[model samples]
Target: MKFGTMFTDILASFFKKNSTQLYPFEKNPTPERFRGNLYYDPAKCTGCCLCVKDCPSKAIELVTIDRAAKRFVLKYHMDRCVYCGQCALNCRFKCMGMSNKDWEHAALNKEEFLVYYGKEEDVREMLENISKPPAESEHK
Candidate 1:
């Protein structure tokens, strides 16, 4: 319409008080069924490859144990994940779930996105055994 009329309207609105939410002072609560993140249960996971197979985005990877071993190695790519919940839905173990904690999944490399599932002690012991510490010196 008229340039002068629009200009005056804009100026008036600029000085007027806002009647909306004060985001800085308020924290909105998440819903009960909010799908936030993905959770993987290593104990229930049978290495069935169901999650890996059904994932449309190919974000989930089924890293099985060594040829001789009968275990699994998880490598879930959170960065590429679309949170479709398809994998979690069809999982026989019911091992997966949408996490409520929403954290920014930022990483510089693809390897950083990989997630491993296992017991705390098992993982710690595995790392310790896999990566031995420096031997004691016998200097005279």
Candidate 2:
């Protein structure tokens, strides 16, 4: 209301400790169970689809290239993920978890939100299949 009152308040705030964290410049430790980016381990995955089924957001999809060879690709839609950790909780093989460190997912492109977790060759194959037109894929 008064200039004197406002001046004292501003001075007090200047002397007081900062209550905000300096993110991007100064990093703070995340909690033990902090859920961030979605990660999938292809080696431990068995193509059971339990994680896929339990996800309420329908963010994860498991694609099986060869069930006999234990080859599978995990399509993780980061944008759709609710970060509820249901997929991690439902994975019996310990193939899925949320990364606390690599959680900075801010991006300008939508394609960056879609992540594929699997062997390099398998991911490439899956990407190729997705890029192909429906008519061409039907013939192959």
Candidate 3:
């Protein structure tokens, strides 16, 4: 090969070898359109259990705790979830939205995979919003 051709090849090889991801050391931000996680709006959810009933994968479950308080604990099995968007679509509360927060959901214990949003303060905003009249629920 010519000297110029050899030099170009060497540079290309060097650059290719150096191209690597620094993952743990450097975190990357997700794009706005990126679908990472399914976040429940707590306020929009009426505990109708539509999502749980319609979920094909059976990954979602709504458990009633305080009947008089209109309280429900929604549990999601990350392992069984296929990210199909069906659960969000079937949701009557309009409380479910896709977020761009992608963190590893793996754990040695199977119970750890189940996520819940049951805190009183955490659901306060959502509950108040859901309790409002239809006309009052216009703007988010």
Name the best candidate (by lDDT): 2
Off by over 4 Å in 1: 1-26, 66-70, 106-111, 120-140
The C-alpha stretches of model 3 lying farther than 4 A from their native spots are 1-17, 120-140
The lDDT of each candidate is 0.73, 0.89, 0.72
* Off by more than 4 A, model 2: 134-140
What does the lDDT read for residue 23 in candidate 2? 84
User: TM-score of model 3 relative to the true fold?
Assistant: 0.65
Expressed as tens digits, the lDDT of each residue in 1-140 for candidate 2 is 89999999999999999898788898888887899998888988889999989989899899999878878999889999999998998888998899887788799999999888999999899889989877745554
Q: Estimated TM-score per prediction?
A: 0.60, 0.85, 0.65
Task: Output the lDDT of residue 77, model 3.
Answer: 84
Model 1 misses residue 116 by how many Å? 2.5
| lDDT tens readout by residue for model 1, 24-125 | 486567776777677777777778898898999887776554324435555577777888889989998898888766645667888877665665554555
What does the lDDT read for residue 2 in candidate 1? 100
lDDT of candidate model 1 versus the reference = 0.73
